[model samples]
Target: MSWGLAVLQHALRQPGCPLCRLQREAEARYLENLLWENVNDPATREQWAAGLGFCARHAWQLQRLEARRYGDGLGNAILYEDLLQRVIPVLEAMAREPAMDPLPLHRRLAHVLRLPRSGDPEGIPGLQGRARCRVCRLGEETARAYAEWLVEGLGDAEVRARYAASDGLCLPHLRMTLICARTRAPQALADLAGDAVRRLQRLLGALREYIRKHDWNYRHEPMSPEERRSWIRVVAFFVGEGEGDGSLDDRGG
Candidate 1:
C-alpha cells in the first residue's frame, strides 16, 4: 500500500502518532523551560507578561507539571503579570459582546475557571468548585491541528475523499473543524463537507459487506486472535492514512 494509505490505517488504529507525541512533549518542555527562565530573568519575564498567557487548559497543564517537578507555589506567582495582561483583555472583549442567552457563555467561562490544577491530589475548584474538563481542551486543540493540516495538505479532491470516509464528527469537534477552515474559500469548505459525506456512505457499505462475509459477531466474534488483530490493523491503516505526497508539508501557515 502507498504511504498515504498506510497513514490512514494508522490513524484509525492509533489515534495519536509519534510526531504528535513528540510535538506535545517538546511543547510541554519548552513551556516549562520558559517559565523557569522567566523566574530568573527580568527581560524574559516582561516579554512573557506582554504576550498572551496560557489559555485556561494550558495553565492547568503547566501548574500540574510544575507541582510534580517542584512542590512549591513559587513558580505560579511569577506568572501573575502574564495572567493579568492576557486574561484582562479577554474578559474585556467578552464584556463588549451583545447580550444573548447567557447560559452557554456562562457555562464555557465557568468551565475555564474550573480547570483542574495540575498535580492537585484533590481537583482544583472551578469558578465555584465545578471541575474544568481537560478533554474538551485536548479535543479542540487536536481538531484545530487536524483541520489546519487538512487545509494545507490535501487538494479539493483528496479532501473530499477523506471527509466522505470519516465518521461524522462529534458536534464539538465539528465546530472546531469548521473554525479551522474559517479562512478557506467558501467553495472549498462546501466541497470538503460534501466529499466527506459521500465517503462515509461508501465506508458504511464496505463495513456491512465485511461483516457479512466474516459472520463476525458485533459483541462476540469467532475469529482467531491473530486474524482479529490483522483485521484491526487493516482498518486502522485505511482510516488513519494520509496522502503520501509531501503536499502536507507544503500547505498553509
Candidate 2:
C-alpha cells in the first residue's frame, strides 16, 4: 500500500491521537533504522558528531531500544563510545577556556564549548536553546508529513469518513490541522472544527456522567466503558498522547 494509505489505515484503527501514534511510530522506525543499518555509516556519524548527539530523552531511548534488541549493551557502547571519543575534546576545550563574559551563562557556555551560539542559524535549539536533538529533526519532518497527509486525506471520501468516525485529533494536532486547512482546504476547517467541538462535547458529557456516577445519589449506577475512561481521554485530549511522559520538554527549562 502507498505510505499515505498505510498511515490512514493505522490512524483509523487507533482510538485516539492518530498523529501521536504516527509520530511515535516514525520515531521508533527511525531509531530502528539507525540501529540496524546506519550505526556504522560515516555520514550519519558525522551528523551526530556535529549535533553533539541526541537530547536526553532520545539518547535514553536509543539505549533502551538497543538493550531490548540485542539483550546486551554492545550497540549502546559502540555508538556512545564513539560519541564520547568525539565529545571529550570539545568538553575539554569548554573546561580549559574561560567564559567570554563572567556571567553570560548561555553565551559563555556556548563560547567555552565552541558549540554553535544561540541564533546560530546553523544549529537549532533543544528544550530551550540548549542543544539540538537529531531525533527531533526527524520528528518534525514526520509530523509535517503526517499533517499534510491529514490535510490531503480530507479530500478523499473514504478518508473523511474514517476521520469522522474515529476519535478526532488531539489539541496540538487539531491546531496543526486547522492551520493547514486554512490555506490548503478552507471548507475542511469548518467541518473539522465542528467535529472537534462535537467530540469534546461528547467527552464532556462522558466526564460528567463519570463524576455523577461516583456521587452518593448515583452510586448504584454502573458506568459505561466510555464513562469509565473519560478521565484518561480528557487528559489525553488536552496534553496530547505521550507528551505527558517525562520527555525532554517536560524536564527542560
Candidate 3:
C-alpha cells in the first residue's frame, strides 16, 4: 500500500464519536511534536518535559514509549521519578483529610511505593519504595532534576547512542513502541515487529564496532538492495493491514 493510501485508511478508521475523534487528533498532534521537535530548543524542551510529566498511568505509557526508542531501562527510571513527584502533593493532601475510607488514595500511594528502588546512580531509591509519605516534597524536587536531565540528556547524541546500544527491546517495550507510534504513523506500526528485528540487527552491528574501538565511535552504514526491499515489504504490510488486523491492532499499532 502507498503511504498516502495508508494514511487515508488510518483516518477513515478513526473513531466516529466526535469527542473520541477530537481527543485522538489532539493526541496525534502532541505525539508528532514530541517525535519531531528538537530536544535542544529551550521552549520545546520545557514543553516536552511538562507534557510528559504525567500521572502514574500516563507516565507508564510515556516510559514505554521511551523504552522502545532508547532500549535501556533509563526511561522507566526517569518516568518513575516523575510520577513519584506528582503523586506526593496529592498524597500529602489526602493525609490531611479526615481518615475515612482512603482506599482510592491509598491505591495511588501504593503505586508510587511499588516502583523499583536501588542505590545505583541510575535509580531513585528515596521515592521508589518509600512506605511513608514524608519524602513527597523531596520527590518533587528530584523529579524537577529529572526533567532537567530529560531536556539535557536526550539532546546529547552520545547519550542517545549509548541508550540505543543497550539491548534493543523486550516484548513489552516493543508493544509499547507500536501503540505509541500508531497514531503518528499507523502504516509503520502495522509491520512493527519486523522493523524491530531490523533495528536490532543494525544496533548489534554498531555495538560490535564500538566494542572493538574502545571509544564512542559513530559511522553510517549503507543498506544493501535486499535489505531495503525487505524493509519496504514490511512497511507495506503495516500500511495495508488496516485497523483490527491481527498484528497491527492486537500487538500494538
Candidate 4:
C-alpha cells in the first residue's frame, strides 16, 4: 500500500487525533534528520536562508529538545548563531527606516477593514507579517493530502470498516472529511458523522460515571481503565493530541 494508506491504517488503531500524530511524527523525523545529518547540508542551509530558520515556537522547541537530549545544545548554537548573523543586519536596516506619522486608531481600523485611507487611499502601509516556518507549511500540506486520500478511498470496504471501527476523527478532520464528502456521498458522510456523535455521547456518559464514582458515596467503586483515560482523551478530542507536555518531545518543532 502507499504511504498515505499505511498511515490511515495505522492511525485507525491509535487513539486521539491521527492527523496530529502523523504531523508530530513527521516533525520529529524532520528534526532528527536535521540534527543528525542535515545541519550543515548546503540544501538545508538554503531552505533556512529564506525564512531565517524556523518560527519562534519551533526555534524554542528545537532548543529545548536539544537541551533535553544532549545537554550541550550545540545544535541550537550552531543554528541560531548563523541565523542571528543573517537577522541582525536586516533588523538594523528596518530600524533605520524613518517612522511614518501615526494614523488615528479609527483610521487604522477603517484601513484594515479595507476602507479607503482617504488622502493616501491606495498605498497606506500595512502591517508586516512574519515568515512562515517551512516545516509547518509541509506538515499542513501532508495532513490535507492524507485527509483527502482517506475521503477519496472511503469506497473501499476495508477502509470504510477500519474508519468506522476506530475512535472517530477529531473535529477538524471530521469537518474536512464531511466537506469533501458533501457533494459525492452525502448519506455515507452523514452516517459517518452520526457514528462519531454516538461515540462521543458514550464517552461523555463514561466521563460522568468517572466523576460520580469518585464522590464520597461511591469511593469504593473501581473505575474502568477507559474511564480513567477519558480526561486525556476528551482534551485530545477538542485540541488534538500533543497539546499536553507528554507530547512535547514528539511535537513538531
Count of clashes, each model: 18, 0, 1, 0
lDDT of 2 by residue, 3-108 (tens): 9877766776766677877777788788888888898899777666556677787888888898889787776677778766645654454467646322343454
Better of 1 and 2 by TM-score: 2
Per-model lDDT = 0.46, 0.72, 0.40, 0.67
Better of 3 and 4 by lDDT: 4
TM-scores for candidates 1 onward, in order: 0.35, 0.78, 0.25, 0.71
Model 2: residues >4 Å from true position, as ranges? 1-3, 86-114, 117-131, 243-253
Worst 10 residues of 2 by lDDT: 244-253
Tens digit per residue, CA lDDT, model 1, 88-120: 543554577647333444445446543223223
Give the Å error, residue 39, model 2: 1.7
Candidate 4 lDDT at 50 equals 49
Enumerate residue pairs that collide in model 4.
none
> Per-residue lDDT tens digits of candidate 4, residues 159-199?
77887777677777677677777888876687667878887
lDDT score, residue 211, model 2?
Answer: 96
Model 3, C-alpha of 126: deviation from truth (Å): 21
What's the distance in Å from true for residue 190, model 1?
3.5
Best by TM-score: 2
Which candidate number would show the highest lDDT if scored against the true structure? Answer: 2
